[model samples]
Target: MCGTCGCGEEGTVSIRKPGEDTGEHTHSHSHAHDHQGHAHEHSHQHKHAHSHAHEGHQQHHESSHGHEHGGNGHHHRHEREIQLEIDVMQKNNLLAERNRGYFEAKQILALNLVSSPGSGKTSLLEKTIKDFKSQKKIYIIEGDQQTMNDADRIEKAGAPVVQVNTGSGCHLDADMINKAVKILEVEDHSLLFIENVGNLVCPSLFNLGEQKRVVIVSTTEGEDKPIKYPNMFQSSDVCIINKTDLLPYLDFDLEKMKEYALRVNHQLEFIEISVKNGEGLNKWYAWLKNLSL
Candidate 1:
């Protein structure tokens, strides 16, 4: 299971391209599955401690202070759990730094786009890919819990794409991005967009070595989403308010959403866009162009 979200299990994650053999997929459980190994090691140590305890069992029966050690044991277990979480995050950060270094050396403009489901993330990508493909060499790493539907759409949009179906994984980790980049053979001096799984929570915790993290929230979702999921907004570098075309039909407050987002992340750059009608897309394209410059 993922230590951060506890959504994925051993052998539950897989990375593959579209139309590839489903039987030939990568089993990636390196994140939280390492806890199982740690547990085994602890168990082995416990057996030795058990033997020692058995040797001292007679002394405990004769002593009146045997219960005093119980509190210490509970404290030690709590510390171990805290340490385990630290270990998981530390390991992820180390890999993320390595991926960041590689991107820097290659001058690859990698952007991690994150959002909740049905936030028009894929649609924004499709529009961006179609509009910018002619000027820049673009590549995509599409992430989802299951299915290659987004990947297929990206492939048709005219960019080299790799689909990572994370089975039960809630978010894409640095290790997954490292592996996907190798498979995609991403070119240097090009655009690499990692469309993270449609999740607001766990995806914000894992850094995929992207140069910028863009969070997309639609107007249809409540204006209070920024405060509700502050971590996602706080960690994001850019906030894309997508699906602006539907504003007239719904009871959505555009200014209130921006106000809430600013409260969470004052540095977050906002781009209002409606992929359906090409509203504010030039600004979006301009932002992407400025990144490459």
Candidate 2:
């Protein structure tokens, strides 16, 4: 399982290129059903550490105080797990720094856009690409658990794209981005948008070496989302309050949401936009354009 979220890792985080057949792809998990309000923990991502059979095996040892090392009891295992978690995160941070250096060298403006499911991230991306595709070289890395649907939409929007299906994993860590970047072969002086998996909680703990982390929150979601999921709001460099066209029909308080977000992140840049009607999108586009300069 992915050490980041404790979800089963049997799912494939495969990179799918446009025009390639997906018939050969097979996975053990699909759909976003894994993230059901569980507090995401350190995913001890070592290959041999955990297995599905471990569940059945663990049930057999109620006490679990094996005498393999002279009855060290559960305390030894707990300490070891904590150490391993630290080690894994250290390794991920190191790799993320490497990715940052690579992007700096290539002059690539990489933005990591994160949000909850159905936050209109893809819609915003489509509009962003359409707005600047002719003047800029844009590449996309789409992350999901099971399908290439988002990547297909992005490809139709006139940009080179790669989809990384994270199977059951709730979030995409830096190692995933490191591999995805190699597959994208992103050019110099271009923009790389990594549309991370639709998760608000687990994705916050891991940094994918992005130049900016843009978190999108729709008007349909509660204004208290910032307080409920403060980590993402605090970590994000920019927060886009999307779907402003629905604001008239919804009861969401725009100013209240901004207040909550600012409470968590005083310096978070905000851009309110509606991809449906082109309202406030110019500012969003300009924000992106200035980042490259």
Candidate 3:
């Protein structure tokens, strides 16, 4: 009796030698049926490699004879299998759908505000909330890895606010928005603004059930930002060139930035504003009204 098998000698274990054309061999076993008629199959023509087994004590081996035969043919097959199995960005898309449905149910016009830190997402929201407080019941969902500072500013503007701390997560997902919505007392005629964690990359991939996605690009960040971070601009329905008040001080090319943004996303509607001076905000508010309506 073989110590490894723990089975009788009648149970035969056969090992086959690697063929001349064989680069590598792999084995997979399934015990759905009895092993009495089990057989192994091999192919030399197939560049990719895979294995399937049915109820058998099968052993596979590799040989150096064909090791350099087009650089590990079996390894390439394994890689293809792995690539096929990957979801890529399925998780994020699914979560985005859930968030979208939730917002639809609530009848809340949610807006995702994305930008680099210090691009004045907070200040823009602050000014907007102050101006629109009398006419609209605005609610804010502030997302940050730490601190309640943004939410605090929104609160001072007299709008209902909820702060979501994502911990180490770089972006907000549907689950976060789902929970954040509960804390916000959004009425029938209400606007929900989600201040996405300041990031040009990660935030664009996430959808927080927002009616609109607005990307804030500051003049100080330069006109090349639209070209460099095309994904963010591409995803946004609106692009706000904030801090235009400093355009005189900085050598920012406004026309070139608009041209680049249009090249990337022809449908992008934009507003140039400075929250400090309250310039270009009325146009923004008007656009928001038309969208919400």
Which model scores highest in lDDT?
Answer: 1
- TM for candidate 2 is 0.78
Please write out the lDDT profile of model 2 over residues 153-258, one tens digit for every residue: 9999988888888777788778888887887899999999999999999889888899999999999999999999999999999999999999999999999999
> Per-residue lDDT of 26-93 in model 3, one digit per residue for the tens?
11112324332342223343322334422231222322234444555443222113347766566656
RMSD to truth, every model: 5.7, 9.9, 17.1
Off by over 4 Å in 3: 1-87
Model 1 TM-score?
Answer: 0.80
Steric clash pairs (candidate 1): none
TM-score between candidate 3 and the true structure? 0.70
> In terms of TM-score, which candidate is stronger, 1 or 3?
1
Separately for all candidates shown, the number of backbone clashes (residues 3 or more apart, or on different chains) is: 0, 4, 0
For this target, which candidate reaches the highest TM-score against the unseen true structure?
Answer: 1
Worst 10 residues of 3 by lDDT: 20-29
List candidate 2 segments past 4 Å from native.
1-4, 7-9, 22-88
TM-score-better candidate, 2 vs 3: 2
